[model samples]
Target: MGTCKCHLKLRKPEDAAAACSKVLELDGENMEALKNRAEAHILAERFEQAKQDAHKAHEKDQNDRSVMEMLQRIDRLIKMASRKDYYKVLGVDKLTATARDIKKAYKKLAVQWHPDKNQDNLEEADKMFKEIAEAHDVLGDEEKRGKYDRGEDLNEQPQGHPDPHTMFFQNGGFPGGGGQRFFFRQG
Candidate 1:
């Protein structure tokens, strides 16, 4: 459809997908529509839909070079999705998240999963706490976040992080770490 192609050219991938879907509904076997929709889905990071469309396109024409390339790219993205995603660790959607959001999420999750609070599940808590810290460290910094956004942060840990215990004491035992609670508590 001209609308679909026009939207794609304008870099409005979500619009392109919608337009292409309208054409596909009328003609399921339209190779151009299928291919364009698949591309739009890829740009939107909707891998499952993109995969489906790519497969359909491939079935329609196994010899299509562009479809084959799309299939390969999808496979690669799927694999990358399996990695430990810092955005996911921080419980934020990367597309709409800002630095403040990432920081807020990290603070919340870190406290919830702090090792002292999860003595019965220390191992899991420690792992989760570390993950949250790492997410904040990477995504909270412009340079690291940029590298991470570009997929260069492979298995990277939070840099120069103090041990959990040290961080806790240094911060005064909580986010504000004022140490007032300890003075008033019996435990």
Candidate 2:
């Protein structure tokens, strides 16, 4: 557990996850190991895996605050990832949005969520602003929009463009975005 905590503190989540795995092998019911591994997995961007470990921890001890918090965070991240509807982000109807309408919608959202305009919630606003920009960048381009419409992974990083979605998930999941609801069940 000390090694796991040290690795995690050093931001070496992969190493932390391995250390936690070793602990789990020795003591499967160790809530601390389960929680630590879940945190490590979250840092590693393995939300589904984290959720599994968190569920196990919860089953072992539902009263554990840390375990419950981890479960909630994992649930939120899974929900956010599964609800990647760019059209919904831009407030455009996927089926009927014209290029002009898409552009208009994007502009509106961009202004509304601009960090400069929402200083009190700068981080949240900035995230929303980026999402709007990404949506616009894809929807404004005919080819990219076509691919996105067909359910391709628009979250994939471009050659030189950093992936905001990855950063977003790493930090704490999507702050606030309206889209289709997704449910994940523990099996």
Candidate 2 per-residue lDDT, tens place, 13-128, comes to: 99999999999999998889999998999899899899899999999987888888778778767765676688888888989999999999988888899999999999999999
lDDT by residue for model 1 (1-187), tens: 9999999899889999999999999999999999999889888888999999999999999999999999988877876677778888888998999988988998899889999999999999999898888789889998888877765644555588656877888997786577555446576
Candidate 2 residues lying further than 4 Å off, grouped into runs, are 85-187
Candidate 2 local Cα displacement, residue 32, angstroms? 0.5
Per-model C-alpha lDDT, please? Answer: 0.88, 0.85
State the displacement of the C-alpha of residue 147, model 1, in Å, after optimal TM-score superposition: 11
Query: How much is 22 displaced in model 2, in angstroms?
Result: 0.8
**Which pairs clash (backbone N, Cα, C closer than 3 Å) in model 1?**
171-177
